[model samples]
Target: MRIAFIILLTLFYSCRGVSQSFEGAWKGDLAVPTGSLPLHFSLQKGDTWTGTMRSPSQTRLDFKLNVIEVAGDSIHLQSAALGMSYKGRISADGEHVEGTFRQGNYTAPLRLGRYDSTQTVKRPQEPVAPFPYNVKEVTFENTASEVTLAGTLTQPKAPGKYPALILVSGSGPQNRNSELEGHKPFEVLADYLTRQGVVVLRYDDRGVAQSTGNFLQSNIGDFSRDALAGLRFLKAQATVDSTRVGMIGHSEGGLISLLLAGQHAPDLKFIVSLAGPSLPIDSLMVLQLYHVGKSQGMSEKQLAKVRPINRKNFEVVKSDLPAPKAMTQLLENMKSVGGASGTLRKELQVMLLEPYRYFMRIDPVPFIQKINIPLYAAFGEKDVQVPAKENQESLVANLAGNPQSRIKTYANLNHLLQPAKTGGLQEYYTIETTIDPTLLKDIADWIKGL
Candidate 1:
């Protein structure tokens, strides 16, 4: 995990009224048009504030907004770490705040209010780099598609043809930077790998950064195509040893890597599955649903009722019926099978519906069984997005009949390969840093051995 820099962190220091008491631990939900998410605001006197957000499922984590600018009752924060900026206003009593979060022209209104602090505390001492990676970034074109893929291709300073790896981001329209909060994991990985005598190709996904395409409208299949295109791009490069080219995929990217391996691409040499799931899409999605509900303190009985509804609704949406009609009915049934009366229900609805449909419609088994490449699958035991046991077990079982697959489960690493306590996403924001160095070493060593 590369430590992204804080461009600004002062709470309205640039504005008047330097005496307001926006100096306590404030917590609330960021109420968006689609749903609500837990937003934590920790304020320190002298114009310093840190913000962290968690998804409804509480698995995906975001970063703490650096350089918070608060003016009187208004707050302005810009996270260059994520190339995002936000502006909102708080009530005089420090009770409520409403503002818009902006990334380029994409903007969304966020509502946050004060709350009681939980037992969770920030761990500033956790192991992480004090500064982000230092590397040269470059851009190249996809000759076949005419799409420009921006990347930071890092190589060892010494002149030599090094083994190369392409870094593929997980779900979401990620830039080549893999900008999580403000941290750029891909940039950091490229630098670290290059320093270890491994060349790395980290590029923007389609529809993100300098790449051309509509990322929001893309699916796993489209992402897979993009990954294949990346592999081809790397293979054609004069500096990259075509036979030594491999892929390092995170989260959904890991699953795609499995599919790529299964396809048995002739140029592919190795694959690293980081927190990838082997189970069917529907089953994995249901597990995600349950995990999110549990994090929000849902009761066992409530989960029992909600779980079946989730699985069934997804099944209905994936049926051969028309998509528009199926989606309409799915929403109706979700509304009927309700949970407690509050923000959680709305959040859960968003969590259960979108990704469930996305994953269920595709199957990776056919692809998983057909691969002839050297396979490496690993997971953080603490990962909540795709639990270690369920994801790795199914993956191992599929590879059980295939003798070439190798698997490892890290006990203390999170989805980002960061050394973590319980490996939860919350730790990502609360702890300042990139992933553990050992994990990086493990990856570098594995690539070298190949």
Candidate 2:
């Protein structure tokens, strides 16, 4: 998921004064490689000009720009939580901002003009009203955490008890539909699968959308409990077959499904890992960063330099030594690569926090190897994050003796499983199709086989 996307910080800023023409709102499109991300910034000129940023494509509808510093006509706004920063100059007329938006190693051109109401993107794949199935908004409580998880449950209209499948969303705080860019793949998948006679339960991640919880404080075990709670809810329903309840997880959700299979093997009949990481997250992250960086046109030299730094950072988190000792080693490693700055140092500490630390240290292979339930895992050939070849190989090797496991990879598909020319994250929004038909068929066919 994105540690950068949801870093919340309470910064105290002194209102310098509302003396400039830069007051009010300015809105524009940040042209990323996949599609345009509509960004709305409301610059309130005060003692220290404050601003809030809104990206219609993102889950957080309104976000306080963690750091926005203005020096004369020069403007600098940053959201360290999102690994995003903007540096530009306000036009002489104070009606425009021309700048570059940077996230990690990715950068895109952004131009803002007079503030306009947030615009909506067309998502044809999103399931509309009058769904063919019986769709209802439901909520269930995770007894251990006492957190309410809200979700949509869709059962075939026939009313007979049917096989149930819980849809677990991937990284980041996603709504019921696992929405990203302009696509609602989970909704589309739910609609299709439900129509094919399966009950589908898709829900928002804890602390996301209608759910309640602190995502920052949650880790894999916390999420595993949520998935298990959803499974319990689905199994207890009269419309679902308790004996045939299964889970289909995408990306991180896939890993969660495996965890469920390992911990709640009796309750979970089967699982599907769609582009799920089979290796330790740290290993997967390096490959992901490299692929994404390469797609963004990062030169080989730059990649070579940064990749090692990132790998070392992960190693620091995974080291078995004492926490302070590990951190000292990490700083030394960072200095050797000229990356030991205050920001990077602080970022390293955040990485050691629960979420990042879990990803770095947790290895799913053992859980997967212990999984006794049937498992169906598939990967997109063109996927950059959690690439197909290596992940598939690991999964296959780990499940060597499990005949119930099915692993396959599809060509020309990106992480989202849409037929993509280039499997870059930037291409996510531009593609019209939510998920490729073949991917759907692969899942449906496997489920039918069970």
Question: How high is each candidate's TM-score?
Answer: 0.70, 0.79
lDDT of 1 by residue, 1-450 (tens): 110000011111222222245656555434322122344556665434665543322224465667777677777777666677767776655566656656664444455656555555443323254433234566666555556667666666566577888888876556675655435667667767777777778887766656786554456766677777778877776667778999989888888888888888766788988888787766766776666555545677766766776677657745665656675665666565442222233332333333334656667777776767778788887776677888877776667344555788887777777677765555665555566676778887777877
Q: What is the lDDT of candidate 2?
A: 0.75
Model 2 misplacement above 4 A: 1-122, 320-325, 400-404
Error of 2 at 424 (Å): 1.2
**In model 1, where do residues sit more than 4 Å from their true spots?**
1-136, 142-146, 335-358, 400-404
Which candidate gets the maximum lDDT versus the true structure?
2
Query: lDDT values of the candidates?
Result: 0.63, 0.75
User: In candidate 2, residue 156 scores what lDDT?
Assistant: 87
Q: Write the per-residue lDDT of candidate 2 for residues 1-450, one digit (tens) a residue.
A: 332211111011111222246678787655332123467788777777687887654465677788888787778888866678998777766667666778775554566778444445566667778777788899999989989999998888886888889998876656888777668899899998998889999988787668999765677778888998998899999988787899999888888887777665568899998888888877887777777777777778777877776787778777676668877887887665554443335445555554556667778888777777788988999998888998899888877355667888998988888889989876876788898888787788778778
